[model samples]
Target: MRQIRRLLLLISAVWAAAPLWAEGERAGDFDYYVLSLSWSPTWCALEGDARHSPQCDASEDFGWVLHGLWPQDEDGGYPSYCRTPKRDPSRAETAAMADIMGTDGAAWYQWKKHGRCSGLSAGTYLGAARLAYGAVKRPEVFRKLPREVTLPASVVEQAFLKANPKMTPDMITVTCKAGRIQEARICLTRKLELRDCGAGVDRDCTLEDALLEPIR
Candidate 1:
């Protein structure tokens, strides 16, 4: 009984001291942030079964969803899992950001894969992600993609730039998967201001024009 009590006490002490995402040597070692906003329809169609998100339920009028806030280096590289412990966000911890991140699997995977490297606790990282996602004003045309509306990358870029006066062409890049518009990735400084990502990061949407399949 004495040994068991001592072990339980030790476990509690370690958890309290370990801090959420700031434990390891690699924490806080990043350059910039990429706030990726995914079109809910695209995600529902593509990775629906894999992620099993609430957005796939088709109950609400879902538009763009927060994919992740990823930390990146100047060279277009990123670190994952870093030196953080296996700290997962509890239900209360994810409440504020769950609306955009999708309450199910998205939040958990993102925290483990990307947020762990941001040098913040799960709550802090999730709160920051919500802020980053809210910073950009999504264009109406993209809020609900027009039926059978296929457009060029430049057109989409222009719409966003016009919507967000502070956002620039170099700072936001449209991403596509299998010729379908997927996400809009915007580069931001550590302070959450728009910034150019430079030539190191290749824009994922290479096609001249991509199809925007309307959300079903």
Candidate 2:
């Protein structure tokens, strides 16, 4: 009886850990999407400039750039690097995304990490990503700033909410990194419709005065 009970307990333990072990094993098995729009100037100030990335070049004039379209689980976990039989995108295909993504490399990386989990082919995923990026209305107000400023992170969220009437407070979040405004993450359905964020993605930055750099 004791040996049988031990075997039962071992089985239960493995079952409980199944989700973690099987993460990214299946494709297209997510609840929703999180569209991350990164503040370009802030990224330059933090990391881009250091790397001498061309996205930070003064002539680039980038504002909010498409960071990634991540598939999320309602339970706050996300799948990534899932196994897929799709062919990788070509150099031209990734380069085309540079206008919105800032670099072909970023586009390729997003595909490798999050896009594979979407169960879509590389071309289809990139096309979906472009459509999703176009769906969001990036507020022109931020780009009009002639100089850097510091404001509550909530202000960024409000700007998005105002520009996109279909989006509510619960549907978007402002995140900060190294005391600078990082990204505005918006929740969306698989079809790209606005939706409330899940618990993990709902974490809004509490910075009362986060730095926002102007477009260079």
Candidate 3:
């Protein structure tokens, strides 16, 4: 009994002294990215019945693009989650295949709309991307996005202004770029500018299809 107790104590000390395995050792490490584009009149001209229609135009604070990948550190090993773009099509799916290809596309679209009206914050976009990639890649690198995102603000501004420059505006584009991982970008176009920090102005509205881009 004494020998057994001594062995047990020795084992406990060794176990306690040993390093604790980190949960994110391979799951938390990851890189993220963002890319943005402006709406072109040619693209915006697309209407109902068109193969791919612009759901929202720059004037209405639209025209944003985002793409991402959870690449591995090893060369030529594309992200294990790359398949996310083709499978489940729903967040509920546990398989990486369904996540990368299916639900991610819808999630991107939702983020675009939500971001436009402030319903979705920048964190929302990053969170969705991370969640999607995590479901598949399980990267170990830190996945938090930078304070500023890398979006094509200039392009959005040019488009919105070309449509109506007389109106004051507040526009911003954010891009999130992480080495190795695919980039993700978002653009926000605002026509109404606050003359005063805490004031509002009259703005007109028209009902149009919530077209951002062709559902692809």
Candidate 2 residues lying further than 4 Å off, grouped into runs, are 1-23
TM-score of 2: 0.88
| lDDT score for candidate 1 against the true structure | 0.78
Model 3 per-residue lDDT at 130: 44
Tell me the spans in candidate 3 whose CA falls farther than 4 Å from its real position.
1-32, 35-50, 54-61, 65-126, 130-216
Residues forming the 10-long window of minimal summed lDDT in candidate 2: 17-26
Better of 1 and 3 by lDDT: 1
Residues 79-101, candidate 2, lDDT per residue (tens digit)? 99887777779999999999999
- Per-residue alpha-carbon lDDT of model 3 for 1-216, expressed as tens digits? 999999999999999997553222232232222122222222334331263432332333222222342222222121222211112233432223223323234344433332222222345444554443333221111122222233332333344344434423332221222211121222112211212111111111221222222222
TM-score list, all predictions: 0.81, 0.88, 0.23
Error of 3 at 15 (Å): 46
Roughly what TM-score does model 1 have, to 2 decimal places? Answer: 0.81
lDDT of each: 0.78, 0.92, 0.29
lDDT of 2: 0.92
Residue 158 of model 2, lDDT score: 94
Counting only residues 3 or more apart in sequence or on different chains, how many pairs clash (N, Cα, C under 3 Å) in candidate 3? 35
